[model samples]
Target chain A: MKFGILVNEGPYTHEASDTAYQFTKAALEKGHEIVRVFFYHDGVNNGTRLTTPPQDERNIVKRWGELADQHKLDMVVCVAAAQRRGIVDTDEAKRHGKDADNIAPGFHISGLGQLIDAGIKADRLVVFGD
Target chain B: MLHTVNKSPFERNTLESCLRHAKKGSAVLLIEDGVYGALKGTTVSGKVSEAMKSVTVYALQPDIEARGVQNRVLDGIKLVDYGGFVDLVTEHNATQSWL
Candidate 1:
């Protein structure tokens, strides 16, 4: 089955990100297709490169990037939510005159239409939220 | 359809509201604080029990364990892992997240 994943909460502080990650990984392992992983609301915090955790702790931001790389996942952070939360890619940083970009690998800032499109294209839309 | 509730029944009426709209034969998944609704006894467990007559209720194992409520989970509410969560979504045609 094909799946559209919607994550609406931040990492570490909320369990939504962890659960979404686990679900996506399990789906892929089961030979299911992922249409897209859309991060909205505080979920965009999962895309920021600036996130760092203690050495023994699991780095949620980097973990998502690694998962995306291994699966070639289309991980999209909502532009409106990202902008509101200060999660910026290089282009967004340049467009907004920010000093630097903080978007992690495998994540692109996009509009909510991507989410709606995922809903239409994927067989199921699985939401992990607060 | 599958309905997911991620808020505590004590904190919000999301679980109640989701159960109210959830049709018979539908699946309801409780995650995060929403696992609180699966407890055997609570102020709102009666509503959950009533809804379970028609709706099949499930709770995420990790969330329930994380909150230390696994021991107190009500009977008949199946516990599922992440893989099981994927299976639930695949089984249902649509999912409504009650955030």
Candidate 2:
């Protein structure tokens, strides 16, 4: 089955990121297809590479990056959310005159339409959030 | 449809609202703090039990374990791991997260 994930919370502060990661990993391990992961609301923070978690803590952002690399997953951060939270990729930074871009690898910034598209394309749309 | 609620029933109305609108035969999976609703003796458990008359109910094992409420979980609420979570999503046509 094809699945799409919608995460609506940021890392560390909420369990949504951890649960979403676990669910995505389990889906891939079970040989199910993941159509996309849409990060919206505070979830867009997961796409930022600038976070410095404590050494003993799980690097949620890096974990997502690794998962995306291994599965070639489509990880999209909602553009509006990212903008509100100051999570900018190079293109977005350039367009908005930001000095630096902090978007992590394997993730892209896109519009909310991608979320609707995921719902239309995937067999199921699973949401993880607060 | 599968409706997932991740908030503690005491702290939020997510579970109650989800149960209120959930279609008959729909599934509800509790994760994170949402597992609190599955605790056997709680007031929320009564509602969960009532909802069970019409819809299937489940809770994530890891979340229950994390919250240290495994022993308190109500009898009819099945516990699922992440893999089972995946299966539930596949088994249901769509998922609605009541955040």
Candidate 3:
């Protein structure tokens, strides 16, 4: 099955993002396809390039990056939400006249329409949040 | 239609209203604190429409784990990841958030 994911939870505070990774791995193992991973609200943090965790904790941002690299899946961060939350790509930082960009590589900043579109194309729309 | 459930079951506000309004073939997804609804026999959980057996009821697995209620989920509900959630929005005619 083709899957589209909606992640609304942040990495550090919630397990939603981590669970998303597990689901993606499970789907791939099951021979299912991941159409896209849409990050919204606090979930946008998953695309930030500035994440740094303690040695004792898991590096979730890197984990997501690895997943995208291995699967070649689309990782979409909501531009509006990302910017509002201080997560900016080069273009967004330049547009807003910010000092720096925090969006990581392998992640695209797109509109919510991509999420809606993914839903239309995917056989299953899974949501991980809280 | 798409219904979003907020964390609280007792609030009887937007989330409750959405649940009450959900029609057949609709979907109800629990996010954030709303995952608590996965409990088997709560009064709020009991209100879910068993009649609409095809209606998809899902809980964010991450939220379920965060709240330490992963094992408490009932059998009928589907544990969805982010991608599956997006598919729901696409499959449905409209999506509504209750919180």
Candidate 4:
């Protein structure tokens, strides 16, 4: 089955985002296809390159990047959420008059329509939140 | 149908909102912090059960395991792994996630 994941919480606050990550990996291991991962609200924090967890903690940002790299996942962060959180790619950073771009590779900043598209395109839209 | 709720009962009527419109043969999946509501013998659990019946109720194994509530999960509620989680969505015609 093809799956679309909607993650709406930050990585550290709760296990929602992290659990989504683990679930994504497990889905791939089970030979299921992941159509896309859409990050909204605080979930967009997963796309920030500046995040650094403590040594004893899980580096959720890095883990997400690694998962994307290994699985060739399309990681999409909501543009509204990203802009509100000050996470932007090079073009968005330039447009917003920011000096630096913090959105990591393998992740793109897009609108909510992308999420709707994923929901319509994929066979399933699984969500992790709060 | 697949129903998802990540908000707590104390905050709002999340369970009601999540399941009130559920279709037949659907399941409710509690994830993230929402697993806290799956604890047996709680008012929250009772309310969840009361609001919806017959349909399967599930909580993420990892979330419940992380919170040390695996043993406390209600009898009728099933625990779902990630693969099973994917199956729930595939079985349903539509999915709704309530925050």
Candidate with best TM-score = 2
lDDT (Cα, 0-100) at A78 in candidate 4: 98
Candidate that scores best on DockQ: 2
> In candidate 3 chain A, what residue range of length 10 has the lowest lDDT sum?
A14-23
TM-score of chain A of 1: 0.98
All candidates in order of TM-score, best leading = 2, 1, 4, 3
Instruction: Tell me the tens digit of each residue's lDDT in model 4 across A22-77.
Output: 88888888888889999999999888888877899888988888889999999999
Task: Write model 1 residue lDDT over A86-122, tens digit each, in one string.
Answer: 9999999999999999999889999999999999999
Task: Compose the digit string of candidate 1's lDDT tens values, residues B1-99.
Answer: 999998999989898899889999999999878899999879888889999999999999998998888789988999999889999888988889998
Give each candidate's fraction of reference contacts reproduced. Answer: 0.90, 0.94, 0.00, 0.71
Ranking by lDDT: 2, 1, 4, 3
Ranked candidates (DockQ, high to low)? 2, 1, 4, 3
lDDT for A121 (candidate 4): 84
- Pick by lDDT: 2 or 3, better one: 2
Who is ahead in lDDT, 3 or 4?
A: 4
Alpha carbon deviation, residue B80, candidate 1 (Å) = 1.0
Worst 10 residues of 1 chain A by lDDT: A121-130
Q: Give the docking tier of candidate 1.
A: high
Error of 3 at B3 (Å): 8.3
C-alpha TM-score for every candidate: 0.95, 0.96, 0.65, 0.88
User: Candidate 3, which segments miss by more than 4 Å at Cα?
Assistant: B1-99
* Native contacts kept (model 1): 0.90
Where does model 2 exceed 4 Å of error?
Answer: none
Q: What is the lDDT of residue B92 in candidate 3?
A: 73
Instruction: Give the higher-DockQ candidate: 1 or 3.
Output: 1
- lDDT tens readout by residue for model 4, B1-99: 788877666667887677677665678898777787787777777776764575778888877887787888887788888788767777787778877
lDDT of 3 by residue, A13-127 (tens): 8756776777677777667888999999999989887888998998888888888898898999998888788888888889989999888877889999999999899876767
